[model samples]
Target: MSLKVKFDELKTLAGTELGTSDWIAVDQDRINTFADATDDHQWIHVDVEKAKTGPFGGTIAHGYLTLALLIPLWTELLDVEGVTTKVNYGLNKVRFPAPVPAGSRIRVTGKLGDVEEVPGNGLQLTADLVIEIENGTKPACIAQPVFRFYA
Candidate 1:
Protein backbone atom coordinates (compact mmCIF):
# COMPACT_ATOMS: atom_id res chain seq x y z
CA MET A 1 0.00 0.00 0.00
CA SER A 2 1.07 3.60 -0.59
CA LEU A 3 1.69 5.89 2.35
CA LYS A 4 0.56 9.48 2.24
CA VAL A 5 1.37 11.64 5.20
CA LYS A 6 2.03 15.24 6.06
CA PHE A 7 5.56 16.22 6.88
CA ASP A 8 4.55 16.74 10.48
CA GLU A 9 3.33 13.15 10.92
CA LEU A 10 6.74 11.70 10.19
CA LYS A 11 7.64 11.80 13.84
CA THR A 12 4.71 9.62 14.73
CA LEU A 13 5.74 7.06 12.15
CA ALA A 14 9.27 6.62 13.36
CA GLY A 15 10.55 3.09 13.89
CA THR A 16 7.86 1.75 11.60
CA GLU A 17 7.76 0.38 8.13
CA LEU A 18 6.21 2.68 5.55
CA GLY A 19 5.48 0.28 2.65
CA THR A 20 6.86 -1.81 -0.16
CA SER A 21 7.34 -0.58 -3.72
CA ASP A 22 5.81 -2.11 -6.79
CA TRP A 23 7.91 -4.75 -8.52
CA ILE A 24 10.24 -3.58 -11.29
CA ALA A 25 12.07 -5.77 -13.72
CA VAL A 26 15.82 -5.55 -14.12
CA ASP A 27 16.24 -6.31 -17.77
CA GLN A 28 19.43 -6.66 -19.79
CA ASP A 29 18.59 -3.47 -21.64
CA ARG A 30 18.48 -1.56 -18.41
CA ILE A 31 21.75 -3.09 -17.24
CA ASN A 32 23.36 -2.30 -20.56
CA THR A 33 22.18 1.29 -20.45
CA PHE A 34 23.45 1.73 -16.94
CA ALA A 35 26.78 0.31 -18.00
CA ASP A 36 26.87 2.68 -20.96
CA ALA A 37 25.95 5.73 -18.92
CA THR A 38 28.45 4.95 -16.18
CA ASP A 39 31.16 3.67 -18.52
CA ASP A 40 31.20 0.42 -16.60
CA HIS A 41 30.94 -2.09 -19.40
CA GLN A 42 31.87 -5.06 -17.30
CA TRP A 43 31.31 -8.35 -19.05
CA ILE A 44 29.13 -9.70 -16.29
CA HIS A 45 26.74 -6.82 -16.81
CA VAL A 46 26.73 -6.50 -20.60
CA ASP A 47 28.16 -9.52 -22.36
CA VAL A 48 25.40 -12.07 -22.38
CA GLU A 49 27.50 -14.88 -23.77
CA LYS A 50 30.40 -14.27 -21.44
CA ALA A 51 28.09 -13.63 -18.50
CA LYS A 52 26.16 -16.85 -18.94
CA THR A 53 29.24 -18.69 -17.68
CA GLY A 54 30.15 -15.97 -15.20
CA PRO A 55 29.75 -16.06 -11.43
CA PHE A 56 26.04 -15.44 -11.29
CA GLY A 57 25.35 -17.73 -14.28
CA GLY A 58 23.87 -14.84 -16.24
CA THR A 59 24.08 -11.12 -16.83
CA ILE A 60 23.62 -9.32 -13.55
CA ALA A 61 22.89 -5.70 -12.85
CA HIS A 62 25.54 -3.35 -11.54
CA GLY A 63 25.27 -2.84 -7.81
CA TYR A 64 24.95 0.90 -8.18
CA LEU A 65 22.24 0.49 -10.75
CA THR A 66 20.28 -1.49 -8.21
CA LEU A 67 21.08 1.12 -5.61
CA ALA A 68 19.94 3.98 -7.79
CA LEU A 69 16.50 2.46 -8.19
CA LEU A 70 15.65 3.08 -4.58
CA ILE A 71 14.41 6.64 -4.94
CA PRO A 72 11.90 5.94 -7.67
CA LEU A 73 10.80 2.83 -5.80
CA TRP A 74 10.33 4.97 -2.73
CA THR A 75 7.95 7.14 -4.70
CA GLU A 76 5.74 4.11 -5.27
CA LEU A 77 5.68 3.27 -1.61
CA LEU A 78 5.19 6.63 0.04
CA ASP A 79 4.40 10.25 -0.66
CA VAL A 80 4.99 13.04 1.76
CA GLU A 81 2.65 15.96 1.33
CA GLY A 82 3.06 19.51 2.61
CA VAL A 83 6.77 19.66 2.06
CA THR A 84 8.49 22.40 0.15
CA THR A 85 11.68 20.49 -0.49
CA LYS A 86 13.11 17.00 -0.08
CA VAL A 87 16.80 16.37 -0.19
CA ASN A 88 18.71 13.10 -0.33
CA TYR A 89 20.96 13.83 2.56
CA GLY A 90 23.08 10.71 2.19
CA LEU A 91 23.41 7.05 3.07
CA ASN A 92 24.80 5.78 6.31
CA LYS A 93 25.43 2.26 5.08
CA VAL A 94 24.79 0.16 1.99
CA ARG A 95 25.33 -3.47 1.24
CA PHE A 96 24.72 -5.82 -1.69
CA PRO A 97 23.98 -9.25 -0.31
CA ALA A 98 23.04 -10.91 -3.58
CA PRO A 99 23.31 -10.42 -7.30
CA VAL A 100 20.32 -9.32 -9.34
CA PRO A 101 20.19 -11.42 -12.48
CA ALA A 102 19.10 -9.68 -15.64
CA GLY A 103 15.34 -9.98 -16.30
CA SER A 104 14.65 -10.53 -12.65
CA ARG A 105 12.00 -8.59 -10.80
CA ILE A 106 12.80 -6.61 -7.69
CA ARG A 107 11.14 -4.27 -5.20
CA VAL A 108 12.04 -2.20 -2.21
CA THR A 109 10.58 -2.02 1.28
CA GLY A 110 11.32 0.90 3.56
CA LYS A 111 11.28 1.18 7.34
CA LEU A 112 11.46 4.51 9.06
CA GLY A 113 14.28 4.34 11.56
CA ASP A 114 14.97 7.75 13.04
CA VAL A 115 13.15 11.04 12.84
CA GLU A 116 14.67 14.24 14.07
CA GLU A 117 14.08 17.92 13.66
CA VAL A 118 16.55 19.97 11.74
CA PRO A 119 17.11 23.68 11.38
CA GLY A 120 14.93 25.81 9.07
CA ASN A 121 11.81 23.90 10.03
CA GLY A 122 13.00 20.74 8.44
CA LEU A 123 12.87 17.07 9.34
CA GLN A 124 15.58 14.49 8.85
CA LEU A 125 14.46 10.94 8.27
CA THR A 126 16.61 7.85 8.32
CA ALA A 127 15.10 4.89 6.52
CA ASP A 128 16.35 1.35 6.45
CA LEU A 129 15.63 0.19 2.93
CA VAL A 130 15.69 -3.35 1.66
CA ILE A 131 15.63 -4.40 -1.99
CA GLU A 132 14.54 -7.95 -2.55
CA ILE A 133 14.31 -10.03 -5.68
CA GLU A 134 11.21 -11.91 -6.74
CA ASN A 135 11.32 -15.41 -5.23
CA GLY A 136 14.89 -14.86 -4.11
CA THR A 137 16.11 -15.99 -0.74
CA LYS A 138 18.50 -13.15 -0.01
CA PRO A 139 17.96 -9.44 -0.37
CA ALA A 140 19.72 -7.75 -3.27
CA CYS A 141 20.50 -4.56 -1.36
CA ILE A 142 20.13 -3.04 2.06
CA ALA A 143 20.75 0.59 2.88
CA GLN A 144 20.11 3.29 5.40
CA PRO A 145 19.28 6.46 3.51
CA VAL A 146 18.88 9.82 5.15
CA PHE A 147 16.46 12.37 3.77
CA ARG A 148 15.81 15.98 4.67
CA PHE A 149 12.42 17.51 4.13
CA TYR A 150 11.61 21.16 4.59
CA ALA A 151 8.16 22.40 5.49
Candidate 2:
Protein backbone atom coordinates (compact mmCIF):
# COMPACT_ATOMS: atom_id res chain seq x y z
CA MET A 1 0.00 0.00 0.00
CA SER A 2 0.93 3.68 -0.32
CA LEU A 3 1.36 6.32 2.32
CA LYS A 4 -1.19 9.04 1.70
CA VAL A 5 0.48 11.55 3.98
CA LYS A 6 1.42 14.79 2.30
CA PHE A 7 4.64 16.61 3.08
CA ASP A 8 3.10 18.67 5.83
CA GLU A 9 0.97 15.87 7.10
CA LEU A 10 3.92 13.66 7.93
CA LYS A 11 4.08 15.25 11.36
CA THR A 12 0.82 13.57 12.14
CA LEU A 13 2.47 10.21 11.72
CA ALA A 14 5.08 10.67 14.42
CA GLY A 15 5.29 7.89 16.99
CA THR A 16 3.40 5.57 14.66
CA GLU A 17 4.21 2.32 12.96
CA LEU A 18 4.41 3.12 9.27
CA GLY A 19 4.82 -0.07 7.25
CA THR A 20 6.46 -3.43 6.77
CA SER A 21 8.24 -4.63 3.65
CA ASP A 22 8.11 -7.92 1.81
CA TRP A 23 10.87 -10.50 2.08
CA ILE A 24 13.93 -10.05 -0.15
CA ALA A 25 16.54 -12.71 -0.65
CA VAL A 26 20.19 -12.21 0.23
CA ASP A 27 21.74 -14.46 -2.36
CA GLN A 28 25.41 -15.26 -2.84
CA ASP A 29 25.65 -13.36 -6.14
CA ARG A 30 24.31 -10.20 -4.55
CA ILE A 31 26.71 -10.59 -1.68
CA ASN A 32 29.61 -11.11 -4.06
CA THR A 33 28.63 -8.04 -6.07
CA PHE A 34 28.67 -5.89 -2.97
CA ALA A 35 32.05 -7.27 -1.98
CA ASP A 36 33.34 -6.45 -5.45
CA ALA A 37 31.92 -2.94 -5.46
CA THR A 38 33.28 -2.12 -2.01
CA ASP A 39 36.56 -3.90 -2.52
CA ASP A 40 35.87 -5.81 0.69
CA HIS A 41 36.46 -9.30 -0.56
CA GLN A 42 36.97 -10.92 2.78
CA TRP A 43 37.19 -14.69 2.58
CA ILE A 44 34.10 -15.07 4.70
CA HIS A 45 32.16 -13.12 2.12
CA VAL A 46 33.72 -14.22 -1.16
CA ASP A 47 35.71 -17.39 -0.67
CA VAL A 48 33.42 -20.31 -0.17
CA GLU A 49 36.30 -22.75 0.33
CA LYS A 50 37.95 -20.68 3.05
CA ALA A 51 34.64 -19.84 4.62
CA LYS A 52 33.68 -23.47 4.98
CA THR A 53 35.88 -23.68 8.08
CA GLY A 54 35.17 -20.11 9.15
CA PRO A 55 33.10 -19.18 12.20
CA PHE A 56 29.72 -19.21 10.48
CA GLY A 57 30.37 -22.63 8.91
CA GLY A 58 29.94 -21.09 5.47
CA THR A 59 30.15 -17.73 3.75
CA ILE A 60 28.20 -14.99 5.43
CA ALA A 61 27.26 -11.76 3.76
CA HIS A 62 29.28 -8.67 4.61
CA GLY A 63 27.53 -6.56 7.23
CA TYR A 64 27.61 -3.55 4.97
CA LEU A 65 26.16 -5.54 2.11
CA THR A 66 23.12 -6.30 4.19
CA LEU A 67 22.96 -2.67 5.25
CA ALA A 68 23.03 -1.52 1.63
CA LEU A 69 20.16 -3.81 0.76
CA LEU A 70 17.88 -1.65 2.86
CA ILE A 71 17.43 0.73 -0.07
CA PRO A 72 15.71 -1.66 -2.42
CA LEU A 73 14.08 -3.55 0.43
CA TRP A 74 12.26 -0.45 1.55
CA THR A 75 10.43 -0.31 -1.76
CA GLU A 76 8.23 -3.23 -0.79
CA LEU A 77 7.11 -1.51 2.41
CA LEU A 78 5.23 1.50 1.18
CA ASP A 79 4.87 4.09 -1.52
CA VAL A 80 4.84 7.82 -0.96
CA GLU A 81 2.21 9.86 -2.71
CA GLY A 82 1.83 13.61 -3.32
CA VAL A 83 5.41 14.47 -2.51
CA THR A 84 7.42 16.43 -5.03
CA THR A 85 10.75 15.05 -3.90
CA LYS A 86 12.21 12.71 -1.34
CA VAL A 87 15.86 12.63 -0.26
CA ASN A 88 17.73 10.34 2.08
CA TYR A 89 18.97 12.60 4.84
CA GLY A 90 21.18 10.07 6.59
CA LEU A 91 21.06 7.41 9.30
CA ASN A 92 20.82 8.04 13.00
CA LYS A 93 21.82 4.64 14.37
CA VAL A 94 22.66 1.35 12.68
CA ARG A 95 23.62 -2.08 13.84
CA PHE A 96 24.00 -5.57 12.40
CA PRO A 97 22.74 -7.83 15.13
CA ALA A 98 22.99 -11.08 13.19
CA PRO A 99 24.77 -12.64 10.26
CA VAL A 100 22.86 -13.14 7.02
CA PRO A 101 23.74 -16.31 5.18
CA ALA A 102 23.46 -16.50 1.43
CA GLY A 103 20.06 -17.63 0.09
CA SER A 104 18.32 -16.25 3.16
CA ARG A 105 15.33 -13.93 2.82
CA ILE A 106 14.91 -10.70 4.75
CA ARG A 107 12.27 -8.05 5.27
CA VAL A 108 11.91 -4.72 7.07
CA THR A 109 9.42 -3.27 9.49
CA GLY A 110 9.43 0.53 9.83
CA LYS A 111 8.12 2.78 12.56
CA LEU A 112 7.77 6.54 12.29
CA GLY A 113 9.64 7.96 15.26
CA ASP A 114 10.03 11.64 14.57
CA VAL A 115 8.87 14.23 12.04
CA GLU A 116 9.86 17.85 11.87
CA GLU A 117 9.70 20.83 9.56
CA VAL A 118 12.84 21.84 7.71
CA PRO A 119 14.05 25.21 6.45
CA GLY A 120 12.28 24.95 3.13
CA ASN A 121 8.89 23.43 2.39
CA GLY A 122 10.24 20.10 3.46
CA LEU A 123 9.50 17.58 6.19
CA GLN A 124 12.13 15.51 7.91
CA LEU A 125 11.20 12.03 9.03
CA THR A 126 13.14 9.58 11.16
CA ALA A 127 12.12 5.96 10.98
CA ASP A 128 13.29 3.07 13.09
CA LEU A 129 13.72 0.12 10.74
CA VAL A 130 14.26 -3.46 11.78
CA ILE A 131 15.27 -5.99 9.14
CA GLU A 132 14.54 -9.60 10.06
CA ILE A 133 16.25 -12.54 8.42
CA GLU A 134 14.22 -15.67 8.02
CA ASN A 135 15.03 -18.38 10.58
CA GLY A 136 17.52 -16.11 12.31
CA THR A 137 17.00 -15.44 15.97
CA LYS A 138 18.35 -11.92 15.78
CA PRO A 139 17.44 -9.25 13.27
CA ALA A 140 19.96 -8.77 10.48
CA CYS A 141 19.98 -5.03 11.01
CA ILE A 142 18.36 -2.34 13.06
CA ALA A 143 18.65 1.24 11.88
CA GLN A 144 17.16 4.64 12.09
CA PRO A 145 16.96 6.05 8.57
CA VAL A 146 16.13 9.66 8.03
CA PHE A 147 14.53 11.23 4.96
CA ARG A 148 13.40 14.61 3.72
CA PHE A 149 10.32 15.18 1.69
CA TYR A 150 9.93 18.46 -0.16
CA ALA A 151 6.61 19.56 -1.48
Candidate 3:
Protein backbone atom coordinates (compact mmCIF):
# COMPACT_ATOMS: atom_id res chain seq x y z
CA MET A 1 0.00 0.00 0.00
CA SER A 2 1.16 3.51 -0.69
CA LEU A 3 2.08 5.79 2.20
CA LYS A 4 0.02 8.93 1.69
CA VAL A 5 1.22 12.12 3.27
CA LYS A 6 0.82 15.82 2.74
CA PHE A 7 3.79 17.80 1.47
CA ASP A 8 4.55 19.22 4.88
CA GLU A 9 4.71 15.79 6.46
CA LEU A 10 7.59 14.64 4.27
CA LYS A 11 10.56 15.63 6.39
CA THR A 12 9.19 13.80 9.41
CA LEU A 13 9.38 10.50 7.54
CA ALA A 14 13.06 10.65 6.68
CA GLY A 15 14.79 7.29 7.18
CA THR A 16 11.40 5.56 7.20
CA GLU A 17 10.55 2.75 4.86
CA LEU A 18 7.76 3.66 2.49
CA GLY A 19 6.91 0.05 1.62
CA THR A 20 7.17 -2.58 -1.08
CA SER A 21 5.24 -2.27 -4.30
CA ASP A 22 3.11 -4.94 -5.89
CA TRP A 23 4.97 -7.29 -8.18
CA ILE A 24 4.81 -6.57 -11.92
CA ALA A 25 5.79 -8.95 -14.66
CA VAL A 26 8.56 -8.17 -17.09
CA ASP A 27 7.34 -10.24 -19.99
CA GLN A 28 8.87 -10.61 -23.45
CA ASP A 29 6.22 -8.43 -25.02
CA ARG A 30 7.00 -5.67 -22.58
CA ILE A 31 10.69 -6.02 -23.26
CA ASN A 32 10.13 -5.91 -26.97
CA THR A 33 8.05 -2.78 -26.67
CA PHE A 34 10.67 -1.08 -24.55
CA ALA A 35 13.31 -2.05 -27.08
CA ASP A 36 11.25 -0.61 -29.88
CA ALA A 37 10.66 2.62 -28.01
CA THR A 38 14.30 3.13 -27.19
CA ASP A 39 15.53 1.86 -30.56
CA ASP A 40 17.74 -0.55 -28.69
CA HIS A 41 17.32 -3.80 -30.57
CA GLN A 42 20.10 -5.73 -28.88
CA TRP A 43 19.77 -9.46 -29.50
CA ILE A 44 19.74 -10.33 -25.81
CA HIS A 45 16.64 -8.23 -25.31
CA VAL A 46 14.77 -8.77 -28.57
CA ASP A 47 15.87 -12.00 -30.18
CA VAL A 48 14.40 -14.56 -27.84
CA GLU A 49 15.57 -17.68 -29.67
CA LYS A 50 19.15 -16.47 -29.86
CA ALA A 51 19.05 -15.30 -26.25
CA LYS A 52 18.11 -18.79 -25.11
CA THR A 53 21.67 -19.79 -25.90
CA GLY A 54 23.15 -16.52 -24.69
CA PRO A 55 24.78 -15.77 -21.36
CA PHE A 56 21.65 -15.38 -19.26
CA GLY A 57 20.00 -18.49 -20.83
CA GLY A 58 17.05 -16.44 -22.09
CA THR A 59 15.99 -13.03 -23.23
CA ILE A 60 16.40 -10.48 -20.46
CA ALA A 61 14.78 -7.17 -19.82
CA HIS A 62 16.94 -4.15 -20.51
CA GLY A 63 18.50 -2.57 -17.45
CA TYR A 64 17.06 0.82 -18.41
CA LEU A 65 13.64 -0.72 -18.84
CA THR A 66 13.82 -1.91 -15.26
CA LEU A 67 15.05 1.48 -14.17
CA ALA A 68 12.22 3.28 -15.96
CA LEU A 69 9.78 1.14 -14.01
CA LEU A 70 10.71 3.02 -10.87
CA ILE A 71 8.24 5.77 -11.86
CA PRO A 72 5.07 3.72 -11.72
CA LEU A 73 6.32 1.48 -8.95
CA TRP A 74 7.15 4.52 -6.87
CA THR A 75 3.55 5.67 -7.04
CA GLU A 76 2.57 2.34 -5.54
CA LEU A 77 4.69 3.12 -2.50
CA LEU A 78 4.29 6.85 -1.93
CA ASP A 79 1.67 9.50 -2.65
CA VAL A 80 2.60 13.02 -1.76
CA GLU A 81 -0.62 14.94 -1.32
CA GLY A 82 -1.26 18.68 -1.70
CA VAL A 83 1.63 19.28 -4.01
CA THR A 84 1.02 21.45 -7.03
CA THR A 85 3.99 19.97 -8.84
CA LYS A 86 5.98 16.81 -8.47
CA VAL A 87 9.15 16.21 -10.39
CA ASN A 88 11.46 13.26 -10.89
CA TYR A 89 14.50 15.39 -10.33
CA GLY A 90 17.18 12.81 -11.13
CA LEU A 91 18.87 9.64 -10.01
CA ASN A 92 22.01 9.01 -7.98
CA LYS A 93 24.15 5.93 -7.35
CA VAL A 94 22.26 3.78 -9.83
CA ARG A 95 23.42 0.20 -10.21
CA PHE A 96 22.10 -2.84 -12.03
CA PRO A 97 23.25 -5.66 -9.79
CA ALA A 98 21.47 -8.54 -11.52
CA PRO A 99 19.62 -9.37 -14.71
CA VAL A 100 15.85 -9.60 -14.96
CA PRO A 101 14.87 -12.40 -17.23
CA ALA A 102 11.91 -11.84 -19.46
CA GLY A 103 8.72 -13.37 -18.03
CA SER A 104 10.03 -12.72 -14.51
CA ARG A 105 8.22 -10.70 -11.88
CA ILE A 106 9.77 -7.67 -10.21
CA ARG A 107 8.90 -5.48 -7.25
CA VAL A 108 10.39 -2.47 -5.54
CA THR A 109 11.08 -1.56 -1.93
CA GLY A 110 11.84 2.01 -0.99
CA LYS A 111 13.03 3.98 2.00
CA LEU A 112 12.80 7.67 2.52
CA GLY A 113 16.46 8.57 2.62
CA ASP A 114 16.25 12.29 3.25
CA VAL A 115 14.19 15.44 2.79
CA GLU A 116 15.71 18.87 2.43
CA GLU A 117 14.48 22.38 1.72
CA VAL A 118 15.15 23.75 -1.74
CA PRO A 119 14.62 26.95 -3.63
CA GLY A 120 11.17 28.05 -4.86
CA ASN A 121 9.24 26.71 -1.89
CA GLY A 122 9.98 23.12 -2.69
CA LEU A 123 11.28 20.06 -0.94
CA GLN A 124 13.96 17.76 -2.29
CA LEU A 125 13.34 14.12 -1.40
CA THR A 126 15.75 11.28 -1.88
CA ALA A 127 14.54 7.71 -1.92
CA ASP A 128 16.75 4.66 -1.71
CA LEU A 129 15.07 2.21 -4.06
CA VAL A 130 15.72 -1.44 -4.75
CA ILE A 131 14.19 -3.58 -7.46
CA GLU A 132 14.13 -7.29 -6.76
CA ILE A 133 13.58 -10.09 -9.21
CA GLU A 134 11.23 -12.77 -8.02
CA ASN A 135 13.15 -15.73 -6.60
CA GLY A 136 16.41 -14.21 -7.76
CA THR A 137 19.51 -14.20 -5.59
CA LYS A 138 20.42 -10.54 -6.14
CA PRO A 139 18.46 -7.36 -6.70
CA ALA A 140 17.88 -6.40 -10.35
CA CYS A 141 18.65 -2.77 -9.67
CA ILE A 142 19.49 -0.32 -6.91
CA ALA A 143 18.99 3.42 -7.31
CA GLN A 144 18.76 6.60 -5.33
CA PRO A 145 16.05 8.71 -6.95
CA VAL A 146 15.60 12.35 -6.16
CA PHE A 147 12.23 14.02 -6.39
CA ARG A 148 11.23 17.66 -6.08
CA PHE A 149 7.83 18.55 -4.71
CA TYR A 150 6.46 22.09 -4.95
CA ALA A 151 3.68 23.32 -2.74
Model 2, span 23-138: residue lDDT tens: 88888899889988999998989898888899998888898888888878775654666788889999999999899988899988888888888977888888888999988899
Model 2 / residue 83 / CA error / Å: 2.0
| Tens digits of per-residue lDDT for model 1, 1-151 | 6799999898899988877889999999999999999999999999999988888999999999999999889778768899999999999999999999999999999889889999999999899999999999999999999999999
lDDT per residue as tens, model 3, 6-45: 9999999999998899999999999999999999999999
* C-alpha RMSD in Å of predicted model 2 compared with the true structure: 1.4
Candidate numbers sorted by lDDT from highest down: 3, 1, 2
Cα TM-score of candidate 2: 0.93
- Whichever of 1 and 2 has more lDDT, that candidate is 1
Assess every candidate by TM-score.
0.97, 0.93, 0.98
Candidate No. with top lDDT:
3
**Deviation in angstroms for 140 in model 2?**
0.7
Candidate 3 TM-score versus the reference: 0.98
